[model samples]
Target: MDPKIKSLPTMAFPQISGIAALGFAFLIVLGNVFLVPAGLPHAGAETGEVIAFFTTSKDIVGIASMLTPLAWVLATLFGAGAVSVLWQSDRDRGEAWSLVGFGGLILQNGAFAAVIAIRLALASTTAHDSTATTELWALHDALFMLNGTFLTLALIGLSISGLRAGLIRQWHGRLGLLAAALLFSSATLAPLIMDQAGPLGLLGLIGWLMWVVWVGTYGITLIRGGAVPIESQSHATSSKP
Candidate 1:
């Protein structure tokens, strides 16, 4: 191995992955704060128009245009680390389960991509005035459950690995579990924002965004510091999930 490269087994890939994950987290937050609001309509007798306005905002446009692909790339990075850290080992009973959990991450994020595609489809079909657009959005709402499912599986897999392998500190493991719960709850409340303004709706977004941010940076400091548990782990953690 090249001396410099040999010093870091993964060739400092984790740092690059961290940067990408942070960028993706920022975009998701940006979409939630500015673009998501625009797509929804404000209160009053014109509530439907208000909901439609935010639902169809340029932000959602930007999401389908840019963020979906970005999410796929970022997810791949996380998946790398996860594959290495959680699923590659026979040390824990959860190894096979973590594989399944992170596998859900792939599927869940795919669902989000589906949502973005559905949004873009709705926008494109508007010019023709088709009933299919409405049907699609309803389907999109249902599909969003996948993202929450992804989070739940991600946290569960890691949390189980943490307990069994002693891979992560207790706090981070607990936080991972909590974040999963928040993410799942968000799916229920996301569509409610259309019915009326409510704290649960806003809190759900905030919680989920925070969840994304937290997960992105989790284990990063240890990974860079060359912590023993991380380095000596039996399998590779792809950082993808």
Candidate 2:
């Protein structure tokens, strides 16, 4: 372990992070459950449909938007906790994968913030301003699709690092990697996928579902004290030597 790196409380960090991760997942699922069936507009939705959704479902959108900030906060906490858990192993191996994962979490927070802001802006716009609303929705779709890149990065970095450090089981690591691949594929095809609301959107949706599961399980593992820190192991090894 690097002396420069401040040590985190093993017990507290995992517990807090586990709670945050579960909270984050719950909020996301909650928002989607309400919003998706409420006729939330998809990418390339008709301008009229988009406007109608914002106008009719203003309360739903507002509620979901309100939850977004909290979700972002929880995600950040989870990422920070994950990094702390992986810090010793990463340092010993001369790797910064956890930092990469952390970066992705931060970037995605900003990206999703923009996405929600766009939704709010659209809600406020007059139906008469169809042109502006359409343009705004387009931007929202682009941002939403592109946001997968950050998610992919987060999954890849953390999954690989955690697996290498034996912080997560092989099944967990494989699931994360698979989710990352799906998300990345969706992001890579964003231009095409965003043009029309087709089956391509399912790719992202599936990946997102997997991501939620992955995070939730990770949180559960932490809560159960499954993620043993590499620092403790290192200390044991070093003392013996």
Candidate 3:
């Protein structure tokens, strides 16, 4: 005779959280693959000259190609999809914490967008004027600071979800938290390590891209069906001591 199964406690939050994580991952990869090569400043002999070269060129298609994925990430996270995911979860408490993480992610990415725009603007000012400018450059700096702050907070909340709860079922949360640390440091602290990396840090972008791939792959997995083996209610409950 076939065995009967107990209806395990449903973890609906995890199902939707998995989906959102995928969206974040997609943009990260899209940004790296499409945007970075398409829009990054070209290398000339001197830093200032290269910045000047890119300023005049200002390839709108290239810029749009890069910024498009970023815009999607921002819009999706703030949109109804993310909120629906939060709502569908089993417990209100988990949803609350996830909201904090979601808010942090949106704010951090938005601030980072400001940083990128500011950098492009600064390039324009630096190239056109013979004299160095501070005002536009300072906007970029402040935005970077804000980005770092929000990114750190988001990672912290995700970390708590993994550690405090000891929720191994949320592997994506753990992975995301780790990826955030790598990318955040790469973007913010690369200059301290080397003069060469300077403004365009390679490590941070690489880390972000990897994060995108991981999250996207996981998300696609869910859309094809559900989070079967991992996020399944029976699967999660069976592993508990």
Candidate 4:
């Protein structure tokens, strides 16, 4: 290690990270659950329907958007914590998967910020501005669907790193990987799916649910300090010479 390089205080924030992760998951779920049933427009909703929803449900939409900023903040903190915890193992293995995961987290935060901004813009527009609302909503749907790509990257990077580092359980890693696959598939089909709302949308929805569960599980595990594999323990011992 370079003499000037400062090591991360990895041991100092597992509990805090765990709580942040849980909070991120909770906020996402709360926003979706609260909005979806309150007549949030579907992906293929007609322009008139979209306009009406935004105009009438402005309060609900505002409430949901309000959760997004805090959720993104919590997600960034959790991502940093995860990267810190995996840094040593990644260095030993000559890998940067945790960093990749962190990048994805940051990118998703930006992407979702744009999504929410568009939503708020729509909410503020009058129904008379149908053309503008239609265009904006279309942009929103496209961005929302494509945002799955960032989620996919985050899941894949973290799943691989956590599993290799023995920091997360096999089932947890598998869940993350599975969610990544689903989310990636959804993003790949974004053009087609965004054109029509149906069972196809369920792909991303299922992936999102899995992602939430995976995040929550990871948080709980981190709070418990995780379990080191025997091989990792041996490697650490051997490196101490």
Off by over 4 Å in 4: 1-11, 227-241
lDDT of 4 by residue, 1-241 (tens): 7645655444558778888999999999999987899898878689889877888899999999999989999999889889878877877777899999989899999999999999888887664487787788889988888889999988998899999889998899999999999998988998889888778898898999999999899888777876456688568556754
lDDT of 4 at 34: 75
Worst 10 residues of 4 by lDDT: 3-12
Worst 10 residues of 3 by lDDT: 86-95
Q: What is the C-alpha lDDT of each candidate?
A: 0.58, 0.86, 0.49, 0.87
lDDT computed for candidate 3: 0.49
Candidate 1: where is the Cα deviation over 4 Å?
1-10, 41-60, 88-94, 126-130, 185-203, 222-241
Candidate 1 lDDT, tens digit per residue, 183-216? 6776665566544556655545555665675665
- What's model 2's overall lDDT? 0.86
In candidate 4, position 192 carries an lDDT of: 89
* Angstrom error at residue 185, model 4: 0.5
Q: How many clashes in each candidate?
A: 28, 0, 2, 0
Q: How much is 89 displaced in model 3, in angstroms? A: 4.7
lDDT of prediction 4: 0.87
lDDT of 3 by residue, 1-241 (tens): 3334455555454455555666565555555564346444422124454455456556642454465555545434432333443333323233355456556667766776676665556545533553343444444444554365565555555444433333323566666677677667765663452334345555454555555554464455444443223344344355556
